[model samples]
Target chain A: MAWVTPVTNRNATARMTYLDMNRISGNISYLYNYAKDHGYDVQGDDVSQTTWTQNDIISYDFWYSMTGVLGEVREAAGLDKSVNYPATNYYSVNSLERYTLYTWMEITEPPEYGLLQNREGIQLQTESGADIEAGIL
Target chain B: MPTISEANKMQIRQPMDIMVTLQVGGDVSLTYSGYSDAKVADGRLDEPNKKMMPLTDLQGDGYPLNGSCKLYRPGYHPTSEEKWGERSNIGEPCSITITASESIGYVSAWVSGCESVTFSGNDYPVVNGTANIYVEDTTATFTFNPLYEDRRIEVSLLASGAYFIFNNDQIISCVVSLRSDLSLINPTLPESEIELQIYQDEDISERLASIPDETLITYSAGYSDEMSPIRNFYLSEKITWADNVMTIHAVDAVHKLDIQLPTASLLTDGSSDTGEATEESLLVFIRACLLYAGISIGIMPDYEDGASNSSLVFNRISLREAIAKATAWGRFGDYPTTWINYVDAGIPKLESDYSSAGWHIYEEDCGDVKRDAARKIKEIRMPVSALSFGDGGNYLTTNVGTGTWIYGSGAFLDFDDDVFAWSVITEQNAGIASVKSDETDYAGACERNALNFLAIKGLMEEGLPMGSMNTFYTQVMPWNSLQLATWNRYIGSSVREDQNLIIIGSKVLKDTHIQSFSTGEDDGEIITLDEAPIEGKLIVQHLNESAQTLYPNIAAQSILNMSNVTGSFKWKGDPRMQPRDSAYLHRVNGVTELITIENITITHEGGGTSAEITYRKGKC
Candidate 1:
């Protein structure tokens, strides 16, 4: 199933089964700390929660976690850390630092079958056609 | 034995401490040790990473976070087991009190900081992680004693007599290993690499962004003046960080080399400077590759034997491949010798008879260091039947050394008089097997040429038949001594073990025309490789001039008694273990046979650091 692009500053759900939400919070806090230490003015919420879950979608702000934080902070601070870093887009887009940090995210539309890995409809059948059952699962 | 302060070399080993440092320059580096303290609170049952200040869980059990060292995977039971996470310093401002309203309403407080509580009127003191108290009066106030101070950042209050645990699990892990190539006889540059895993910290997250390439990393273990050598593993720009973990992978000089040859030649064309114009010496070619890789030569002797001094040709290829081609040929005498190159301890070396294989410790040869149950060695044996001195009788002997040596005039029925070669086959080899001499082109009698050939191919085995080691190659190689020894394990006679000797693969041998003649004087006294030249420009006594050194069994009887090279032994990792080094292993019958290390892998995880050494037996 494809990733769902998180909605901006709104109710957004996440897959927290394998994902450690505290780590995500730590990651966001680290990003904010890194930008601040590198002499950049950035603003963010207190991600000090001990634990988090995908079910807690109320005011979760997944958008602020992904592309909105640094992407917006860099724009406000008049710094383009795109391909150049330390020198405003100095490092290459394919550089090591770009790969280490979560630089970008793309959420494609979910597959027609939805986000369930083991899609229930993988074995196709005509359930709407009530005349006869021809398919063997 | 391991070089330690004798304290660390006890029969039972201690839990070793590890130090992984990335050295960009001299003293400037980054070091990480395992965390020693943790924080415990109330909400950590469902939220493991929940934050709490003054993390002073002095008696909390430490189930060390995963990704810790494999050797230290079990729970962290420090020597002072009960007081595992306590700091040396302890202080509290004053006692605390809690007030309750109802008589049967017992209040349970799940405090993040200290949980030990004591009533003002009660005589006894209490200590623990959680506290619950009961009072019979309608309203009651309880007093708590002083608590020790640790790195208590913050703590939030929750309802219950519950306790949650959280380790300040700062360090994820680090791993280091040396990867080697498994090509025998050929000159291949094997790569050595090391990897480090650093868990992210909220304050110092910026360090991950500035990691540079080509930094040197050294890993050392053991608590003594002496340490194991896990050095020369270089760091590349390949790094990754996700889920608060950062990793860096590095390699040796061999792996990072990307030089293309025909490197700026002296001769130039009008359009461009090309390597096609002039053929350069092999020494020049070797230097170009090693120099470009930022690797110094092993400082060994530069050879000028046979065509080694002769100019050679090569197109645009990797500098490493060119080096292999340059070292395969160069006739020293009757036997053709070969040369090979490899990276040794960060230096590019042209090594063939690795002398360092003598002292490099793959296993505990001295038997001083204690070993664990995980240590084991497997025996590999590939045997042969017999060793025919020159040959048996026929030329079509399908085995490795079965063909008979022939030296009578016109004894060779198929080959031309000019194209002299051993009737050798590709038994256990892949090279074009060659031999060469300037005398092959000397304008003389067919018999005169044959004498020079005998001088080169050496005397045929009749009364005392000794075969000089001929290790020639086309594009590949790998061999052992060409001398015969008295180790008849099977049929009970002296035999020449498998050198897989490729003795006839040179320009003077392989590239010849097959001419034929009848036995009725049709060939006209062509040649004989056994006798000295009777007439043309030759002497009988001159044959033994450079011939004695080839057969080292004369005085000391230093015959390089060879055997099958398939035998290899494995041991656990030790920092001192180095590959390509040779040492003695007690094989049998009190015979401490010299073994050459072909591979070495030292792992610094799980229980303690161990080194696995794979060695080739008795080929020297």
Candidate 2:
């Protein structure tokens, strides 16, 4: 009977999965512990066993250290550089989007971030000491 | 035999192409082209690289699909080669030779391509230049000029396809060489002959097919764009081929008649009587002789009415010789005289007066000298006496003893003053009455001989200019009987002089018309003109008519000769000038006289055209 539905009658629902930060920190600690036990040097500034939270460890120094360890880990896993899915996924989603974000951030807040935030619903936070002791950092 | 219509058709339809086939041992090479293919083709024809394209789908009659066949140059292994585009290494040089065939048509090349040319000794320079060699009767040989070891060059001879196009309309050139012993006086003799040479590759068969047997051929001084002005000849033999050359031998029509027709005695069935002894005109006699030989008369002289008549008795001579004898007697005291001349169609024509056509001769310094200059003058030797009579004691006179009697009449210049007189008396017993009758017949025969001698003497006394006028540069003469006669008499005699030279004056004693003689026989004597009448015959005196007509004619002609400036002059190739045609000479001394061309020789070659004309001074 009506040509178009009224805006008041329209309703929609969306679902999203968030990143498990605790798991991520735990995985990083395990990697660091494995490297120390195997007598591999953690050759990077400010990258040690104490820096387990995502914020402290999300630096160029930590990333450089992780790249060295990741290469060894990849060898231990019998994986080739070209078929390294973790490295490939990290560069594809993070490095490309980071360059884009940096370019727009120099001028103004990127509207593209709104679309990303809405699509992924990701939230970044600093972990408390209690959370770190609970092994959820 | 082909009909005239068929011959005429063939004449118009000339062969368009010439085909040449060469066979060396087992190797066969066939070449064909249009008559003008080599001429119109691009580049030099003598180059080894030039391919003579054979013709295909030829259109014309008498051209075989394979072409008129002829043997290639035989024996001498000449080779040639042909290439299209420039290839870096054209392989070894191949020796190619080109020569002109005696046949008037077609040029041939021996090609041995893609072969190494080997010399006898030294390595010769490779022939690399393209040359447009002109084909003429001149002999030329193109060789490496170096001695070769093998003399045979290995060549890649490119095959010109089987069929080539040829333009048959090219002018047919030929060289006609006459036998060395040919004489104009007795042209019918076997020794007088002609040989024609033409290119063997030419479709001579087609040309010959167009020409029927006994075909008349007219020769000129040079290549004739117009009609020829020369005497005509009849083909008397079949064409012959040898060494890739064709030859044609021809003879005069009169000669052919002499060979074909039987003797005069045979024509008359061995009868002594030629015909009714009624005085017959010369024209009538000539007509009768030609009619007897189944020949029709064409052009003839127009003698004056009531001209001299002759009662000649033809013996065992050929028809032509008999006709000659008759003409000799008939021409006595007749103006211009008559002779049997043949036309281009092989038809015999009797000509009387001079021809109307005349040749124009200019001075040497005239503009376009080649077109007008008379090249040279040939003085034909004139006979000392026109007629001479010798009586060999074959007939006996009743009053005189048997002895040789001599008499002659043609005395014009001082050179002919000696009397050629002789008497031919028959042997008989002394004082025999029957001898008188035979004497009358003998006298009649003598009179006839005298008349013949006088006629021929008169004509020859004028001096016939028999030398050839090389009118090689221009064709200006027409075929006619007019001649040029030059006189070397005194200046005062240059004017017409009427000399009353008696042609014939004789008297014989016989019985008077009113009187009668009795024979001592059983029966009386019969009267007849054949024999001195036994009773009524009278001593008759006869005088020739030269005083009335012949003297004046001779005087007029003599004056004409004196005025004539006859000398041999070369003329530019003019096909129109023919024997007997009139020539008007413009002397440098301002003396102009109308003369006639007696003979002409036309020579046409690549260099130029010229005619050798023998002319005399006379109008008619």
Candidate 3:
């Protein structure tokens, strides 16, 4: 199972939490830019968000919507917005399927080195609840 | 589109008696609709003194809708009272202002019985026979001088020698326009439009009925020996027989690809093509598409899609849109159709332009660079939208998002589902690609990567971008894709340090799975379009080609963002000078510019050929 379950945290109050979500927000600078480029009049109040944003898609709907939008980008066949082109296994492409496997081992209580809101440093906790300051870049 | 040798060019340029053999399916007859009906028998419709032949229109624009199309040779000199053909050029003619109440169409003094001789104009001294009149709603006096540059001036009549001969039937005249402005990034060259007027003795309409749609019209131009490379094929679309002339209109092979193909069974997702051992390629897919389209293969690119037995993917769209979306890249050149010659003489068997088959990417990344002495001759892929191949689009970070809260267009476990629980495609919100280890349901969504792009962006062509002040016209190339040309067979990449994808115009529009499409009209049922706004299904059905769907799939509306082609020129005519042909255009200053042919307009009449070439400077 993925570390952050979408159903469980679709509307998380915190911003820029997950590494991949923030990274994908940075990976794609096209969402709002493409909307402007294609004359796709923005339907919501937030039309100004046109650059790199780690401000979260926030729900399964927006994430899948972005995926569907990717299908709109011209390419070979992999941009599957529908099942018509499904081998039914292409979703495992890259690390997508890998994340779906191996349950995320969560600890019931915070450990001695758990992260805190007041200060910012680095907290590395392994599956066995140990802490380390590896400083991994 | 073939490359003619310098010698062939010189031979074509040399003034010679170009033998013209033009024939339709059978005999045809055409009657000129001008002048007095009284003089129809003799073919002379002018006054005894000014016997000028009526002017014919070459292009289809500004065809006199009022049926009063009257034009006499302005060749007749009024000041010197010189006869027609005496002057080498057409100088301005004299005209006078007329009242708004006067009838429009020109009344020629040359015609057998036409005359509105109220008062003579300044130029004509002999007698008032020609009147270029203009009328308006109010009593405004209008000076009606013919705009020499209008569509009317572009036409020229085919002399008796240039007429098409087919037994008892005869072709009066024919005009053809090939390719278009270079900026237009269609997958392949567009269809050449042809219009012919035939004079018939009997009702050959019965025989002509068999050659309307689907029949390939094999048209060969230039000398008999050199005509092999100049032949073009067209599918007959419409034929109209009226006033003894058979008018036929046809298009190129792109039209033949409209039929639906079993894409699900042919083009799989290619899961095995992922990982290190796998990548992207368009070869097999292209062949498969052509087979389903029933189009014959003439030229195939060099790239190959990875292991053919990859996991199947699911996607449904129109065949035309599929071909337009899929692109390939390679080093390609045009040649004669001799490899796939006509079954019999003057008949082509679906050899629609072969160059279109290799319309995969050609010199995509190498942007607008002037002549690179190092790379002597390179290909010019149609300039697509900048967002296409390179420049990573909305890809999931790390190909799999860091599991978190998520929101997408489709429904899932909740309006706000956990990122790990995020999934969609139609109803279930489950199958992303497939179910994997520890996952209760499938969840691969959009981790997609684009190696190429659909060159469906519209092009705004300007003869001289530096000179034209008006807004350039945006023309959609309509057919090409990411198959931009490259020395290597990989899609251009700017984000990824390692270049991995390879495509050669695959069986892009294939069906790897053999599932039948439901024909039920449940897509929509519009009882009436009277008051209701247009529904999605109605729009899709009426659009016919599904071109309205995501298939025109161009990510951005790229208009004149990048332009390699600059200007154009005119030459007597070269059958070998097709659209997209790489050739040299010699300027008056003795400097020869290597140019890519963008648009070609050819007129063959009176055993003579003339071509108007729209070209761009050849570059990276």
State each model's TM-score restricted to chain B: 0.38, 0.35, 0.38
Looking at model 1, residue A127 earns an lDDT score of 20
Tens digits of per-residue lDDT for model 3, B30-74: 222322111112222222223333222112232121222222323
Report lDDT (Cα) of residue A107, candidate 1. Answer: 14
Least well predicted 10-residue stretch by lDDT in candidate 2 chain B: B466-475
Error (Å) of candidate 3 at residue B479 is 42
Measured by TM-score, how close is model 1 to the native structure?
A: 0.33
Q: Which candidate is the best by lDDT?
A: 1
Clashes of each: 38, 104, 85
RMSD of 3: 40.2
How is the predicted docking of candidate 3 categorized under the CAPRI scheme?
incorrect
Error of 1 at B597 (Å): 1.4
Q: What is the lDDT of residue B184 in candidate 3?
A: 25
* TM-scores for all predictions: 0.33, 0.30, 0.33
Tens-digit per-residue lDDT, B1-620, candidate 1: 33443433455555445555443212211111111222221222212123322211212221121221111111333222121121211233123232223342333333333535445466322312334454454443333333444312122321222221111233345445453432222334557666666554433345445546766655655554565554565777655777776676877676545565422221111211111111123445456667776766645543432221111223344655445333322212222232233544433456543444444332343323232221121221111111123332323222222222121111112221222233333234322222323333221112232322443343332121221222111112222111111112221243333323223322121221222211233323332122211110101111222212111111011111222343444433445545555566654345565765556565554445555555556432
